[model samples]
Target: MKIARREAWTGRVLLLVLMAATLMPFLSLLVTALHPSGSYPLGLEWPDDPQWGNFATAFTAARMTELLKSSVLIVLGVVPISLVVATMAGFAIGHLRIPGRRFVFLAFALGLTLPFEGIITPLYYLVRDMGVLNTRWAIILPLIGLFMPFSVFWMRAHFVNMPEELSESARIDGAGTWQLFWRVHVPLAAPATSSLAILLFLWTWNQFLLAIVLVDDPLQRTMSGALGAFQGQWGTDIPLLCAGSLLILTPTLTVFLIFQRRFVTALLQGSLKG
Candidate 1:
């Protein structure tokens, strides 16, 4: 009993420490953002007179409305297509056991190690040759491809662990390949797919390196990507910069908070099955 109590206390303490570590930076940013523009505030000091209008100023100056639209469009373009392709590939490899599936899975596994920075230079030239540089397609297309390996791996993990009895029963129902996947498996995979969609949405929305490198126009870049331009113009104004940074970060935070339950559920489901 004493040992169990000690372990419980240890876990609680660790969780509290981790929670503080995660939230401290955000707290500091909020505190710093409330300071008067062009006035340097050290650390997490609360201002005597907080400048709440800084957020509005940052929003107007950064043209956040347009950035929001661009981000939405880019996410819409990337996430759905990625989910579809990754799910299909995973189904084939995990459920169907298509010919040469081992080799195909190996290829995707190798692709998982290919770092984004390593491919950027070659990607630049390829996009330039294709004449899609400086456009949304440049960001959209590459992100879909870049995301595939991990996405497919995630889905494959879920599908491979699913009971073979389910597939056998579906086949006994005279269901063809498409019907079996669509009717039987897809519904059961909702938690997995929804969680995957949330992650893809976050990744696509926050894609900065690709957005900055491929798209020159600040207006065309993802919200995080536009941080480069926003910082360039206002780097010296610490408070405004922090405000803009928070503005850019809000959507992602909101998304994660709203769907965190589903995400946690999916993760637990996978772990339990595994």
Candidate 2:
């Protein structure tokens, strides 16, 4: 009993330490951002009078208005569409167990191993050839494709882990494939789907490399992508830079905080159900 209690305290202390280490930089960034613009803000010192204008300056100077819009549009395009496709593919591979299911799943597994850096060059030329070049489609199309493998893998994990009785019961009740997916499985799959949507939303929103390489116009790129060029122009403005970064991060953070429970539920649901 003593040993177990000691271990629990040690673990809790270790976790707290880790959390502080992780959050320290972000706290420093927030402090730096709130420091009056012209003044040099350093260390973790809190400014006496916080520079709220830094946000406004950051918003306008960074062209956050347009960048935020582009990110929203891109995410809105990517998440739902990707979810639909991945869910369908996952259900087919996971639930249906169609012919060559192993091969199909293997192909997707291989795709997970294929990093963006490896194929980025070819992808550039491919997008150019498709005549999308600097357009928003340039960012949107590739993201959907790149997002597929992992999305499929995630949803498939959930579907495969689901109880056979659910599907069997539905089938006996005259549920066809589409009917099973739409009416029966989908409701039960909500936790997994919500989790997948959050992951997709994060990936799509923070998409940087492809957005930067594919779309030259900052206005057309993801907020994180636009930040690269925006940084070049305002690199010296530390407060503004920090402010813009936080703004870009806000939506994701908000979503995560709001739906963090669902995210946890997804994992638990997947694990316990399996």
Candidate 3:
């Protein structure tokens, strides 16, 4: 009993330390953001007078309203279409066992190994040659393609691991492929689909490299991509930068918080029976 209690206490202490370590940077940023906008503050020290208006100042100056709108449009464009394509492709590969699926899945596996930095240069020229540079489509189209591998991989994992009995039973009820997918499989896939949407949403919102490389206008780039330009203009202002950083971080965090339950449920859905 004493040993178990001691181990429990030790684990709690370790987790507490890890939590503090993780939160320390955000704490510092929050403190710095509250400090006077013009002054450079460092460390975790609190300001003598907190400038609460730094957020507002950052919002207006960085044109975050427009940035956020652009981000929403980009996310909408990328995530839904990506989800539909990924879900269909994943179903075909995982459930239908389409011919050449293994080969195609292998290709996506290769895609996972290729990072944005590795492909961004050629992609930039490709976009330029297509004459869509500085346009929203520059960000939108590439992101859909870029997000495909992981999204399809994620959905495929769920579908592949799903009980074949469920599909068989659905077919026993005279369900066609479309009916099985829409009425039976899809309902079962809700958790995974929502989780995929959340991931794609976060990825699309945080897309930086392609946005910076392909699109010229800040209003056309993801929030994270536009942060570079924002930094260039206001990098000297630590408080404003912190505030802007928080603003950029807000949507993704909010989304994760809201869907975190569904995300965890999706991840664990096929892992156990009860």
What is each predicted model's overall lDDT from 0 to 1?
Answer: 0.94, 0.90, 0.89
Looking at model 1, residue 117 earns an lDDT score of 96
lDDT of 1 at 166: 86
**Candidate 1 structure, TM-score to reference:** 0.98
By summed lDDT, the worst window of 10 consecutive residues in model 2 runs over 35-44
Residue pairs clashing, model 3:
none
Each prediction's total of clashing residue pairs, residues at least 3 apart in sequence or on different chains, is 0, 0, 0
Index of the highest-lDDT prediction: 1
Q: Best to worst by lDDT, what's the order?
A: 1, 2, 3
> Candidate 1 residues 1-274, lDDT tens each?
9999999999999999999999999998899999999999998889999999999999999999999999999999999999999999999999899999999999999999999999999999999999999999999999999999999998998899888898899899899999999998899889999999999999999899999999999999899999999999999999999999999999999999999999999999999988
* TM-score per model over all chains: 0.98, 0.95, 0.95
Q: Tell me the tens digit of each residue's lDDT in model 2 across 23-98.
A: 8878888999998775677699998998988998998888787888899899988999999999999998998889
Error of 1 at 154 (Å): 0.7
Clashing pairs in model 2?
Answer: none
* Weakest 10 consecutive residues of candidate 1 by summed lDDT: 161-170
Best by TM-score: 1
What is the TM-score (0 to 1) of candidate 2? 0.95
Per-residue lDDT of candidate 3, residues 203-227 (tens digit): 8888988888888788889999999
Flag regions of model 3 displaced more than 4 Å. 270-274
RMSD of 1: 0.9
